[model samples]
Target chain A: MKAYDLSIPLGPMHPAFKEPLRVKLKTEGEVVVGAEVDLGYVHRGIEKIMRRRPWQKAVFLAERVCGICSNSHNLTFIETLEKISDVEIPERAKYLRLLAQELNRLHSHILANLALFLAIEHETLAMMLLNVRERVLDCQELLCGNRVILSYNVVGGVRFDTTPSILKEILAVIDEIEPKLRRYAEMFEHGPLLRMRTEGIGYMSKREAELAPAVGPIARGSGVRFDWRMKHPDYVDILDFKPVWREEGDARARYMVRFDEIFECIKMIRYLCENMPKGEIRRRAEVKSGEAVHTQEAPRGDLTYFVRTDSFGRIEDITIRTPTIPNLGAFVKYMLRNSPTIADAVVIYASIDPCIACLER
Target chain B: MAFPKLVKIGLRQLIQGPVTNLFPKTPPVPVPREFRGKPRYDREKCIGCGACVKVCPSGAVELIEDPTIENPKKRKKVEFYMGLCIFCYFCMEACPVDAISYGDEWLLSSYDKFDSKLIVRDLPEREQS
Candidate 1:
């Protein structure tokens, strides 16, 4: 083998990544032979700060871990807290939380596809994806009062209740966007440029995917259907979702998985909203000493939060293993290892939907 | 062949026109009434319970203790530093007396971030009990 032809550093501050992360690629002319990802640039010590805060306040810290998937973090933190206290929230609250999480999933999947299209230099598709995403954001704002950092989930239950009008507005927004979302899926599947650019690019094998332990769409795309939702108590009963997967194990496969999952999200959201239970939004939650863990499917993949609470209900220790950490490993080892071109490697990085802030938090 | 897939969307876009505001020419779409914008604290209504200060995630709300003052009422002070506010409205929710509220005014920019108009402070005589 000859020495590498060139090395390209993709970012600590680059357009490809909205956050600070660096991927060093060594290439032999056009083909990437090796890649080294350097993280920790956006580490804000959110976990350390979370440990110091009262257990009630740590969900906000978790919400700050990732801007795009704030609902996932916030929900996972409170679910872990509830687990520690053996708190069974009300029936209506469960459906409401499910609504928010699925809406968030829809929002995040659209963003991932948008980023992928952008990587392919398909600006029209990316802009259209963003336009479609605004509907999800509006629905979230209607449901939870804020678009991004929704402090919607409290310990005993959700903080806000959806009136009939708000639910109707959410349905209207969903109705308006569903056709557009379908169009995006078709465009990604059959669009000559998108399919040509993404199909067969950034291939990862099932065995490699397993070893990297990539969860969510990456694992599913690789033909190893490992999703936390199948086993998660919160979702297993509520969301009648089947895992969306593809056998290709390529960038297109990963994007397709995300695209298909949005339909499931839409169905689940509509079901929850139409059949929503009427009850109290929340009850005062009190806690005592215990340790508990929560694993949930964030938009990226499996996010785990493990916590230990003191006798007085103060959080003694908290460990958050965000999904992107493992997915980042999967990106470097499975997808980007001995890959084709440097450009393909970059698209592969986006294919994993890496949230560096979540990883570094 | 190069631009084949986007033809349908391109035609749709031609029909829909642009989705953004013209800034100076047209006012932007209004935020929903439920929108959580800038936070404001009512000095007259605050009982100095300090709930907002404790629950504020960023320490945007502070209890400016007047150590030199003799009166217990005068010594207890609550300050709203808008600069640190994350617009999460945790303070508004945490306020025991419902003194903290979200104002419609979202823009709080100034060369001096600490401008007097930007901050909500209690006068020493505020709510003299």
Candidate 2:
């Protein structure tokens, strides 16, 4: 019997997708033959909004681009402003900013892993992961007043300073969560069901990953040893940071990379808390007419922000390139590979950890 | 090995009951000291400077002049719409008189989006010296 090709559109509103992202797939029986993606569902014209707001207000607006990595958006925007104005941030502010960014990374990785587990029908594991993640959110709330939309970073520095008690609380939280994170890593490594679902699924070669130019965990999973944290020492010099990589270039590899990264981030946060510098949290800076670009390794991947200011210190243009955009290219490629079944497509897509809000914004 | 691992987790969970809260019946989870929730407007201290109106990212704050009085120094009333507040506390930071403060009122749900409880209005006559 000959198999007929079937066309299926997965999500703009499906249980598999965390956000509204539709993928057109052509399959023969259960194996996908072709795939195409549609973005811009969550686009709020964030760049246009930034251009209209004053330089000071734009930082808050930038944070609205993505809730999970809101601090990175604000930090990158402020860094761009600092570059245009040539403002020198205090050492204490730098450490605080790094702490917030790392904490965000920890939570985001856990959330991504949770989503993958949920997609694979591992509800118990997902619940356990989420329970651990709540502690991270609580820590964030204790530090910055809000759980998700931190609005922590200001133009020249951070919005608030940390106390000894706050640092102690943070250390306590880290100490508690680190062991649970290890258990999770162990489960991912040893669990037969998880291995069956993730291992050898959605395979991408190092060459393809580089060609697609995947960033963050997706790139590192494919054995591409590229991370902004290692390259940009000026921003992340405090931690003895190293890029985590896996040669498998599959869904399991990405899962392992993120799992290991959570531990790395925990170490970085501990370091920041230990050697936190004492100084002013913020310094007022004047913005002048200029253009500047800033890049940071967001939990998903490398996020770049380009800002251009006019002669009157008003924003002329603001553009953001989120990590999910390039990873989407890799997603399309992953779907078309190995003749993935419908189930495999969902797992592979979740593995990319696509943030459609960030992509559309 | 699998039996031991399963038994270990099961015994641990048995030792430590549930991690969730019994809220509404019990008290709500306590917010952190710096938790930004509902903005508490101090009518006595507010100078009607309209700074909060200007700095609010969500346009949650508004200043209205009292048209009933024909005096040159007509006192202005400040209105805060909780529905639009992002809880960033930008209004608190911008208030010169320190009239705006955030309280730990996390449960602010209502069926009506335009509920009167959502809007905190400072009458002109209530303005303190």
Candidate 3:
């Protein structure tokens, strides 16, 4: 009997894959038969950290889970705390939270898709996509003083209020960003290099996509009309926007769906910015003894946060289930049969937009 | 036919200038006046209120009080450690005096681990213009 062995280590610190998941592929003659994802490098025991911190303080601390989806974690923490305490967030705050969360989605998906483009060797297209994404980053920095971690979400409401001046700056930025983004979209649609890399690559069938616990673009790209904003009308009621979907279950479809969603986010932000309610942005509430579960769709997928508060100020327990876990599962499944080479396997992995840091946290 | 075509492409490439930026040799790009970069601390205006230290998520800033300064009215020394900084700019935002502002210099790579630590010394009363 003869056996052939090959092990390709992806990253603890890699540019191609986000959040440092070690991809160990067992291949036989350039065809990957199996792949196992190992994660522990970026784990900071955030749940343990949350346990030590006070309930109110955990809102700020939890946002550190992932820089890209910081606002999502903040929303999750706030919603969980509110549920546990049996308090309703003010209508205005809810609107603002939804607005911030959607904008985060728009930016994160673009960044991830662009990173995939870069990995696939569509350098020019990647640059164009990233350049458009810079507008979103700039707007975030101007709004919250940071591009990724917009520590704007607080327990009762948001810390920062958008005044006319802030709105005007945001509008000016969106105005500058939209036309450039449109050009990129046109270029992406027509670019042969983009077509060559992504068109038929990483193709996951509809049946497989349905069985898998996919969320966000991963689910939507497969023609599955499942958006949290649709099922939960609070997001739509608060922000007033429709969900975007695409039918093709391929890499290019995911790219197109994300591009379309960017416009939807812009419209949502514009509406919320224009019709911001004149009221107290935050509600006055204190954490009490109870337990509650909060689930929200992060940029990647559904983010579940479990919280248990005690009589004292400190939170007793907190557990986070990131979207990347299920997304990684789908990637492993697809790559096992589809990708024949190490590069192919890597490309398939990148397409899912895995956030290892979020998983580890 | 192919040889002549290759020569023409090669000659065109030779005439076109290099794409690489002359980084060290040339003057740095002019940062816009309003552009925010690294945070620089002006110790004179700082009241040692510790607002920056409290708001820092990464615990990068520390308020070091000096007992040697006898006058109760005089402010104590507060040192800054930029090494552990997440560059969130919360310290500058929380500063009541607005003594700290963004600097355009972002070349913060240090050969020695301690060199990245930016410590501001308090100027004498005479030096305070």
By DockQ, who's the top model here? 2
TM-score for chain A, candidates 1 onward in order = 0.97, 0.97, 0.93
Question: Which residues of candidate 2, in runs, are more than 4 Å off?
Answer: A1-4, B11-17, B66-74, B122-129
Off by over 4 Å in 3: A1-15, A28-30, A231-233, A340-342, B1-129
Q: Give the Å error, residue A149, model 3.
A: 1.9
Better structure of 1 and 2 per lDDT: 2
Higher-ranked by DockQ: 1 or 3? 1
Q: What is the per-residue lDDT of model 3 for residues B1-129, given as tens digits with 9 covering 90 to 100? A: 659977996899799986445888877655533234556777767788988877776677788766766765555646666566666566766789987776665556676644623443443232255
Q: Rank by lDDT, descending?
A: 2, 1, 3
Over 4 Å off in model 1, which ranges?
A1-5, B1-17, B64-77, B121-129
Candidate 1 residue A336 C-alpha distance from true site, Å: 2.3
- What tens digits encode model 2's per-residue C-alpha lDDT throughout B10-126? 999899956777666677777888888876787657777889888888888888876665554646758888888888888887888888776777777999876887877653235
- TM-score of the B chain in model 1? 0.66
Per-residue error (Å), model 3, residue A242: 3.0
TM-score of 2: 0.93
Arrange candidates, best DockQ first: 2, 1, 3
Could you tell me how far off, in angstroms, the CA of residue A232 lies in candidate 1 after the best superposition? 2.1
> What is the number of residue pairs that collide in model 2?
0
For candidate 2 chain A, which ten residues in a row score worst on lDDT? A333-342
lDDT per residue for candidate 3 within A6-122, as digits (tens), equals 776777666776556688877787877777788788889989988956765576678899888888888888878877777776777777777677678778978888888877877
**How well does each candidate reproduce the native contacts, as fnat?**
0.48, 0.78, 0.00
